[model samples]
Structure formats: structure tokens, C-alpha cells
Target: MGRYQCHLLCRWFFTQSLCSVIVQQRKTIDYSAKQNLLSYATESSLDHLGYMTDTPRLEAQSALTTFEFRLSTVLTGAYTIPAGTQITTGNNVIFQTDVLTEIPPGSLSGTVSGHALVPGVSGNGFLPGQINALITPLPYVASVSNLTESNSGADQEDDDNYAERIQLSPEKLSTAGPEDSYKYWTRTANQNIKDVNVYTPAAGTVEIRCLLKNGDIPSDELLEQIGNVLSATNIRPFTDHVIPKKPDKVDYDISIKYWISTDDKSRATLIQSEVNKALEEYKLWQRSVMGRDINPDEIISRFKNAGAKRLEITSPVFTVISEIQAARERNIECTYEGLEDG
Candidate 1:
């Protein structure tokens, strides 16, 4: 059952006027007609003979959870270690060499880099000088020092993310071979890809830039997979050459001042909390899609609606960039400039 069909069903079960009102005010209704419609259409229905439609699963993205550490050795002889040699942390988390390295003849130590063999977000978010213990004890290997910082591990996708992707399926299916096609294909590869910008620089060349939801760089493996999928004959025209790349990230700094009538510390705190929440929501809305300009008016409206007595935006005087670029909010700073006299 689609929305129209659900509406008809609703009308048949209830009064036509009531069903129309429910459909119109679905946004506020606890049991939204749109949601009910999706449930009926995707799930089993008496008219459809109880066959459930397939839904897209939420994708899990791997974070670079481990960092490369320099290995210092006291052994006074040339030694060659093959690529993929395992090095273990004190907690037994495994790391593998990214490339083969050879200690020069008569050299005491050489530099080598490794990454976590296991994917997904886990382990203590270790910083430099944190991982000192090695699982495999070797006399030649004297000490290990992390040269770079390790990112905290991430978990699998949640239900809310899964539903959001499923909602985009209808629009994706409607697109033919335009920019929307590239966006749809990229999203199919990974749901964490929040924004995709497509540019046709030449007659035969298409560039697709993607931005991750978590604001981190996409891994090389993920980029390769996207390239492979887009290169398929059925997915893209043979005459067109596709380039998959990451977008240039631009961060926005926001400062807000709002007035409130109350002088009570707790009441002021509550208003500040609401304003902060609204700003966070605005950031999400701004980055929800690609090629969206940063509208300062929207921010002002959001603050005013958050019970601000008088609102002034000191930063982001105007829209940041055109729709061609992908922009993300790096941080937001809000201040309540004392109570208002009104």
C-alpha cells in the first residue's frame, strides 16, 4: 500500500474528512500516516498476500583505529621483514605492516608503519607514547613508539540510519543517467557518505566528490570500491570517464548571542541548552545533502524559535559558499549576553 492507497484505506475505515486531516497533519500526528503508509507498503499487507518488501540495510564504516609506530631496535645487523608482519599491542590488538621494510646494513633501527588488522571501532583510543607493550617479544625489537594519533573505533549502524537510507530509495529509483545517478550509486556503496557533489568538467569526464557523515577521510579501499561500481557499463555510459574523489572540506565557525528575560541561573542555563540543541540540529540540516548553501537566515530563525528574547548572529554574516562545494560545520560557539529589559 502506497500513501495514496493508505489514504484510501484510512478514508474507508474512518471518515473522509478525518483521514484527510490525518494525512495533512501527518508531521505532528503521533502515528503519522506517512509512517503507517510506509509500514503497510514495505511490510506484509492483506492485499499483497503477506510478502514483505526488502529494505536496505544500514552500512557499517571502518575507522582508522590504529596508528603507525616507529620500531627502534638494538640489533646491529641488516634484517629484512616481509610486508604483513604482525605486531601486537599490549592488549593483544593486532597491527600489520603496510609495506616491506629493510633495516640498512650496520643500522641499529629502521622506521616501519602498520595498521590494525581488525576493522571497526574498538580498543582504547590510544595516543602517542601510549602503546609501549608488544605482544610478540623479539630481542631485535627494542621498543615501539607511536608516531601518529589513533582514532577511536566506531560501532555498527543503528536503526535510525537504516530508515533514512530506505527513504531515499524512491528518489534514487526515479533518476535516470544524470548527476542523481552518481549520487545514488555512491550512496549505495556506503550510507555514511552524507554528501556527494558531481561535476562534469568536460564532455566525457565526470568527477564525483563524496563527504563522509563523520567528517573523516574515506579510506583507500572504500574509494576503490566506489570506482569499480561506477565504472560498470550498466551504471555509467562507456563514453564517460568517471573520477571518484573526496571533497574539499570547509568548516563554519558560528557565534550567537541571545537575550532572555529571566535572571535565574537555572532558567538561563535551560535557555542556553535549548539554543545549543537548535544549533546542533541546524548543523545536521545544513550537511544533510550536497550542494546546499549555508543560509544565515535559517540560523537566525532557529535561534529565535528557541525562545530567544533578542537574537544576534555575530558570525557567518552571510551564506558561506555556493551549492557547488560541500561545507560542514566544524564548531559552534553560543553566548547569552545577559538578560533583556523589556
Candidate 2:
């Protein structure tokens, strides 16, 4: 009887020990099944989908700007700044000349296109005077500086963005006459674009309004680049007139006062910090897309989720935004109204 009881106990303990491992294995199998679907796929699975759809992820882009080369004195002969002459901003970020440039005899300087060595947003946003250090020294070359702000640098497409593009790749099979086709091509031009609004206001006219990732109005440079892409003979319909422009911005402000529950007064400071964080997140969600309405109700929900017991939003009443316009936040004021009875 004792030996039978010991065997039974050992069997029970072994089964119990295997339960957790069995559950984990089941979870892994379920997750692998989920990745087979496009919506739930990530990383390598998403990349595989992109490959099947013939839409590869967009790669990081180098920043392009203008660099001017100066001489100590006007020389009798033209001074040539060879292509690939590297320049830096004293920091590690560097730019190279895109083409060979010449300072004509009697001319003090000449400008050439500059391309960033690093390909990503990190190489962007340098002001004109920021890139003055020459990595390659030349005879009589007094200085080298960017003539304009560094622009057109973009990061590689993230998984979510790439997935969206893959979803839209079917539209590319058709001519650019359809709105979705134009949108797919526009997104393919730059990975940083957030939203696209296509409108045919008149016969043969295709007006495209682009909104950047962070509610930044599209720069003229970006608009021109998209325009060039859409203007290609094979891409644009013969009757289509493509005009790329920035979406009109509808400015709005936020002002909110919130109170914490007195029952939870011990966490008042932590809740206040969380409420502030929620407000900024709300602002980002509000402006990141085109045609998103300004809704104080969203603010109220976000604040409440952050442990705000009550909120009084004075600004940002619900406003309808047109498809061709984006909401922009001009100002924000948030006040903590102290603990109150819940």
C-alpha cells in the first residue's frame, strides 16, 4: 500500500510540473499561427508578406543640401572643387559634394550639391552655417559651408508603415488615374509622409495634399519631389494634371483643468505627471493624421484614463475637419485643479 501511494504521488507531481511548459508551448503555437495573417504579422513575417506583394520596405534616405566652397582670394584660374570632397559639422555627421564645382577666375566661391554620409533623420536639420568644417583640405580653399538647411533625409520604413504600403500595393497595378494608385506612389516616394488627400477639383486636375508624419506642413522641396514622381510619363495619365501641395492646416488649442480624487491623494503627484503625459499624447494623436476632428471628448477620456477624476476642457470643441485639411495645435494649457471629492 505504501509503495502504491508513493508511485501515485510521483506521477501527480510530474504532471503538475509539465503544466506550465505545456501552456507555454501552446501559446507559442498560437502566436505562430497569428503571424501567418498579414494584420498580425511582424518583422520577418511582415517582410515576407512585403516580398510576396512585390513591395519592399523603403530604405533610409541621405540628406541633400547645397555646399559652397570659398577661396582665400580670387585666383587667376578656375579653382575646381572635385566631387566627393567630404565636409563635416565638427560633429561626426558629414556631407560630400555631389558634383565637381568650379570657382571661376574672379569669383570668390561656388556652390555644389551636398549629400549626407549618414542615411537617416540623424543627418537632417542642420542649418546652413552648421556644416562648415572641411574634412578634405584643398589649397587656397578658405572655407566650406552648407548654403541651405539640410533637407530630404528620411528614416527607413517601420514595420507598420511598410505593412500599410504592402496593403496599398494592389492599387499600383492600375494606372495612376485612381486616387488610391496616386496615394501608393506618393507614399513610395518618401517613408516620412503620414497622410495623403487626393482631389479632382476640375477636369484633368489631380491635386494631392500631403501631411508629414508629425503634422509638419510639407516643404516646397518635398512637394516638388512628389510632383516629379507623379509627372513621369508612365505614372501619370495623359489627361491627368498632377499638382502636389501641402494640406491646409486648421489650428486649434487645448486648455484643460483636471482634479484628482481625494480618496487617492497619496498618488496625486504621480497622477498629475501621468495626466500631463496623456495630454501630449493626445496632441500627437490629434495632429498626426489628416482630417482628424478636434474632439475634447478624446481629451477627457485620455485624462480620465490617466487617473484624472474630473476634467474641464475650455478649448478644442468638436470641429469637423475637411479631407484636404489637417488639425494643427497652436497652444496648450493644462492645469491641475487639486484633489476633489470622488
Candidate 3:
């Protein structure tokens, strides 16, 4: 009683109205049929690529800088020679050679932050009587590439590991059609023609418009039609027998929009029913087995995991939080005030 404040009413009313609109829009909006296809995820592209489905990968851009330096008086520190020391080509011409008892020679070194030099003699010896200095830039800075950084390509190996781990099974594939089926017979009997059934993974999206605003939730038959269209395309997995999952649990991602109108609580039921109907049809979208028998348990298990079977909602008024939780059973997976955990 203490928590049931007046301000809660306004917030509650607003939330309900907003929920109603979101659900309604989801029920009515047609995303699967939209043709403005600029880009798509690999899953979506499976439809166009057929059984030869391709997966997406990451790529990197290359960035490298080219650096250069010249051994000259202005760049290197200046050193004057005795104007007449014809240092021979192979020997003294090189800097830091076996020199006289006391002649000052020039030198060079590389720095990480400063301009680097290629490994080479900077300048050479004295030319007596010439009044010219041979600036032997002893060691110009070395280019970054020249240094042995010794990277074992750990990043490359990691990327390759990911690629190897990604299972690249085709989204669309064709095996021999059912035994004695026309597709099977025709392809098997004829060598000239290939058994390529133009396969496309189904693309399904729903727009929900509030039924209360429209006077009533759609009829069961109309809802059934929606289900049919959603599941008509191939993609949904089907199995002949139930497969046991080792972990006994699964992870999932889901989004929901709903409109709440107290004018008729019936609308919520109607929409939920519609969703169930659609899902039932989707379950039937198994690949054609032809003459081969299929496993029933596998099909059932797959159906459960493939579609979103639960509905959840939250309350704007915190006062009735417990009541909303009570309205939905734990098994039913309903939330009244919190967002779904990713």
C-alpha cells in the first residue's frame, strides 16, 4: 500500500500504450518482402548464393612509411681535412680506418625517435692542399625495416586459427532428392542435366500492429496464413530424430515489441497465438527427404530451438512488479520490468 503512489499510474499507462504500439508494428511490418537490399549478412546471402554459401571474414589494411637520408655536409656534422691526404680508395677512404697517430675522425649513429640512416660509410678522408673536408657520415641512421624486430607473426596465426575454427558449411545444399521422386529420377536417369534445385534460405520478419486498435486480433485462419508465408522458404533445420545436446542448455538472442491496451486484454492472446501458428508452419520447412523415412524426435527438438517460443514484458509501475511475475510462469519465460538478458 505504501508503494502504490499516484505518479505510478501515469507511468504505467504510458508504458502500456507504448508496448501495444511496438507489438502491433511487429505484427504488421513486412521486413522479409522489402526489396531495398543494399547489403546483407552471410546468413541472409545464403539465399542468393544457393548451396555454395560463403562465410564472411575480417581483412586488414596495410600502412607503411618510406624514409630516406643522404650523407651531405649540411645533414652531417662538418669536418675539415688537412687539404692533402689522398686516402686510398679501398682503405682509408672509409671512415674510422687505421689512421695517423692523432687525426680527428667523424662518426654516425642511429636513434629510435630521430631520422635513421642506411648502414654505410658517411664520408671519407683528407685531400691535402684541397681545403675540402670529407664528411664520412660514419653511421647514418638505419631504416626501421632494416632492424630485425623478430615478430613471429602471432597475430597472423591467431587470425588463421579463427578461420580454421569457423565451420563453413553451406547454408543451402542439395543432395539426391527423395527416391523415385521426379527430381530424383530425372537427375539420376539423365547425365546431361544436373540436380540443382534452386534453393534459397527463407527470410522472415514480422510487423505487429495492435489488434485492439484494429477492432480485433486477426482470425485464426489469417494467422495461419502468416505462418505459412514465414515458413514457406527453406532454411529452418529439420531432423528425423531427436538429438541430445551435451550441455542440456542453449543460448539465444531475441527482440520483441508489443502494444498493450487494457481496452481488450484479448489482443495479447491473439498476437501470441498468431506467433505460435507461424512457428508451427516454420517447423515443417524441412528439406525434402524423398523416399527416406525421417526421425520425429529430432524434428521436434529442432523446432523448439529454432523459433522464439516465449513472450516477455515489463511494467512501468514498479508497484505491480510481483503481480506481473506471478501472471507469467517461470517455464513460460515472461519478464515484467527488466530487459531480456542477452
Candidate 4:
């Protein structure tokens, strides 16, 4: 059965809205004078029916499967470091150098880079200067640092994400044109990919832009993997040229003012906290994918939802941009003026 129909059946059979009628009937029985066998039977039947209806729904839910996204880190060190040498951040996250960086014959050190040995959203999201040191020492390596921010660490895909992909699977599975095939392969390459856009500039030239889960650009390794997958004979058109690129990033600068009730002096702090949280959530929502327009009204609505009696959004004059450009919220600056008279 379809998931939606199964849910409907489960709700109809197990919900209190359905059982309440039987409960009302039981209450009307004149059990004050004598035992009501019919009422007891009705209650028992209701309980059994609820169990029967909910079991299949729960089983179907349990049977559903999901894919997980791989996590990665980028570690950099001096030259002449051997591959497979382990380094770590202070938090116990370990990484190994991928290639050996050899200096000239007499030189003391060289430079190399590596990634996290394990995957999953753990260590830290792409925070600069986060990876500090090595877990152990290597002979030729002098010092280590993060070349680029570590990112793309994600947990297993949740139900909503999985369902959305499942709905699109039919289109992807078809033997459509190169554009369709490009999208199919790119998305399947990494679960952390938030969205993919395909453009055909010429007869056999294809441009694929990818947006990652955290709104950051995809790493070189990720792009390489995507290129490999799309270049496969079965996945790509033999005559087409595929070029993968990252979306252009656009940062937003927002300033706002909120009017708070003067009667509650302590509310000033709460109001500021709420406004800050709302802005953070707005950034996440806005940057989650590419091609989203920046709307000042949406920002104002967030403040209203956060309990601001009155708000004025001062910046971001609502501009329309292309899908290839992604809006980002970095170093958000917010001003919480004093509380206003209610």
C-alpha cells in the first residue's frame, strides 16, 4: 500500500477521534445498577482494532531504508610526510596524509594534505583554524594544520529527505537526455549534495553546479568523485563534455531593530536572544539550497514569530539573483535597541 494510505488507515483505526465514540457509549451505560458486559466488550474491541491497525503501519515504517552521507576533513603538513601518517585534531578526530610531499635532496621538509579516516558529521562543520595538531609524531613532518575547512559530515538521511529522493527516483531512472542523467548521477554520488543544476552551453558541453548540505562549496575530492561517476559509460552520453563547478556564494548583511514591552524590564535580554536565534535559523533556511531569493519580509516574519512586538528590517533591500548564486549568512550583525513602550 502507499505510505499515505497506510497512514490514513492507521489514523482512522487507532486515533482517539475514532475510539472516543465507543468511550462515549460506555459512559452512557447504566453500570451504576448492574455490570455492563456490552460496554466492556466494546472497549476491548476498540483496543484490539487500534493494535491491529497500527502494527502494519509501524512495520512498513521500520522496513524503509535510508542512505548516509560521508564526512571528510582536510589536514595539511610540511613536506616529506609519508602517506598513511596519522594526524588528529584535539577532539580525537584522526586524519591521514594522502600523498607524500618530498623536498629537494637536501631540504628538511615538504608539504602534504590528507582527509579524515572516518566519516559522519562529527569533529566540526567547516570551521577555519579548527584542526590543531597531530595525534602522533612522524619523522619528516614538522607541523600540521588544516589546509581547507573540514566539512560534509552528515548523519543518515531522515525520512523526509529519503522520501523526496524516492519521489524523484522514477525520473532519474529513465533513459532521458544528458541533463536528466547528469542530475541523477550527481545526486547519487553524495548524500551531502543539497542541489544540482545542469546547463547545456553548447551542443555537447554540459555544466553541472553543485550546492552542498551546509551551503559550503564541494571539496576537490567530492568534485572528482562526481566527475568520475558522471563520466561512466552508462551514466554519461558518449559525445558530451561534462564540467562540474561550485555555485557562486553571496553573503548577506542584515541589521534590524525590535520593539519590546517596557513593562517587562527583563524581556530586553530575551528579545535579543530570540532575534539572534531567528536570524540564525533564517540563514540556515536561506542557504540550504541554491537559487533562493533574499526576501526582507521573511526576515521580519522571523522576528515576529520570535515574540518581537514590532520590528524593522534595515538591510537587504530584496534583490533578485540567478540560481547559480547562493545566498549565505556569515558574520551576521544585529542591533537590539532598547525596549519600546508597549
Name the top lDDT candidate. 2
**Tens-digit lDDT string for candidate 1 (213-306):** 6444555545665788788777787678898876656667787777877644457778778888988888877766556677788888887787
TM-score for each candidate, following the candidate numbering: 0.62, 0.84, 0.14, 0.64
Q: How many Å off is the CA of 267 in candidate 4?
A: 5.6
lDDT digits (tens) for residues 159-262 of candidate 4: 33443344444455444454655675687666677688887778888888888765767876577667888888776767778888878888778777677767
Clashes of 1: 2
Q: Candidate 3, which segments miss by more than 4 Å at Cα?
A: 1-60, 71-138, 142-342
Candidate 3 residue 266 C-alpha distance from true site, Å: 56
What is the alpha-carbon lDDT of model 1 when measured against the actual structure? 0.63
Preferred candidate (lDDT higher): 3 or 4:
4
Question: Each candidate: what lDDT?
Answer: 0.63, 0.87, 0.26, 0.62
Q: What's the candidate order when arranged by decreasing TM-score?
A: 2, 4, 1, 3
Strongest candidate by TM-score? 2
In terms of lDDT, the poorest run of 10 residues in model 3 is 240-249
lDDT head-to-head 2 vs 4, winner: 2
User: After TM-score superposition, what is the CA distance of residue 181 in candidate 1 from its true location, in Å?
Assistant: 3.9
Quote the lDDT for 273 in model 2.
91
Error of 1 at 46 (Å): 18
For candidate 3, write residues 1-342 as lDDT tens digits: 345665698789989989989987875554443422223213333233322334232222111111112223233343332222221223332111112221123532221111111111122111221212223333332211112111111111122222222222322233222212222222211111211122112322222111111111222222222234323234222321111111111112222233334443445466445545543442233111111122333333432343333333231111221100111111222222222232
